[model samples]
Target: MNILVLCTGNSARSILGEAIFNQLGAGRVRAYSAGSRPKGVPHPGALRLLERRGIDTNSFRSKSWHEFTGPDAPPIDIAITVCGNAAGEACPVFPGTPIRAHWGLPDPADVDGSKAEVDAAFEATWLALTARVAAFLALPFEKLDPRELADHLAEFGRMEGAA
Candidate 1:
């Protein structure tokens, strides 16, 4: 199955989600990312965080959602919005009847302060997405129907960090 994770910037949360899903899904699922408004580059802190986890950040780039709407574009099995702004905005109509879900995370790029503080924000977001993606991968995909899978994905969106 092919999945597209969307956000406003396509720089941090969506990028991290794509990488995590791609890694955990193995060959069972392929993941892609796009944004309502491209940031033109992956966020530096996001790159650092992924690198620290041993995931390559070289292939990531911010891209517009329009790329997924064309005839030659890959048909998306699922499209998940990973931030509040992107979830609220009107998205490009995907070729297939793509299942939509929201897995909103706090925007690490929006966090301000020292370099250490910024890195901490990105790390926290990464950990949150990693946990949710791990839960998603644990689901029995072969047995559940597409709608059920979408429902479960949405449930992942609502999870809060352990206090």
Candidate 2:
């Protein structure tokens, strides 16, 4: 399955979601991320967090959703908005009418504090997404009907943060 994760900035939450999905998906799912207004580079703290998890931070980048709208773009099996801003913004209609889900998360980049505090926010968001994604992968992908899959995906989004 090909998935596209989106945010307003594409710097933190969305970037982390892309990396986590790519790692946890384990080649069965191809994950990509883009933003409505990209930050031009992945957030340094996001890079550090992924590095701590031993996931490669190289391919992650901040890009525009337009990159996925062209004819040559990869067909996204799913498109997820990782923040409320991007979720509310107008998005390009992807080819194939991919399943769209809103995994609303607080933007770590918006956190105002010292470096350590900022890092903590990013870590929290990362953990929340990881939990939801892990649950998502546990589903019986081949057996579920589209309506069932959509329901499952939406349920994944509604999951609260881990205690």
Candidate 3:
């Protein structure tokens, strides 16, 4: 399945979400991340964290949602918004009827303090994403219809620390 993770900034949470899904999906899913208003680059802390996880951080970049809306774009099977702003905002029409889910996560970059504190916040967000992603991947994807899949996806969004 092709999955797209969305956010307002495409810098932190969404970027992390993209990485976790791609890593844990085990080639069963192809995941991408984008923003309504991109920061034009992935957050430095996000890159550092992904690199620590052995993810080749070089390929990740903050991009716009429009990239996935074009005729040539991949047919997204699911679209997940990882922040409130992107969840509430209207999105461009994707190539297919992608299952939409809102997994609102607090922006780890919003923390104000030393580098260690900021990294801690990012780490917490990463763990939360990992939990949600793992749970979703555990689902019986072949048996669930679109409605069932969407509902299951929404359920993941409501977990503690996700909102």
- Kindly list the per-residue Cα lDDT of model 2 for residues 1-163, writing each as its tens digit: 8999999999998899998898899887889999999999998889989888998787888999999999999999889998988999999978888888888988888888888998898899998999988988898775787788889888888889522
Candidate 1: tens digits of C-alpha lDDT, residues 125-144: 88898888888888887678
Off by over 4 Å in 2: none
Top-TM-score structure, candidate number: 3
Q: Which one wins by lDDT: 2 or 3? A: 3
Q: Rank by TM-score, descending?
A: 3, 2, 1
Q: What are the RMSD figures for all models against the true structure?
A: 1.8, 1.8, 0.7
Candidate 3 per-residue lDDT, tens place, 1-163, comes to 9999999999999999999999999988899999999999998889889888888988899999999998899999999999999999999999879989999999998988988888889999999999999989999986799999999988999988967
**Selected candidate, larger lDDT, 1 vs 2:** 1
Q: What's the true lDDT of residue 9 in model 1?
A: 95
Mark the 10 consecutive residues where model 3 has the least summed lDDT: 43-52
Clashes of each: 0, 0, 0
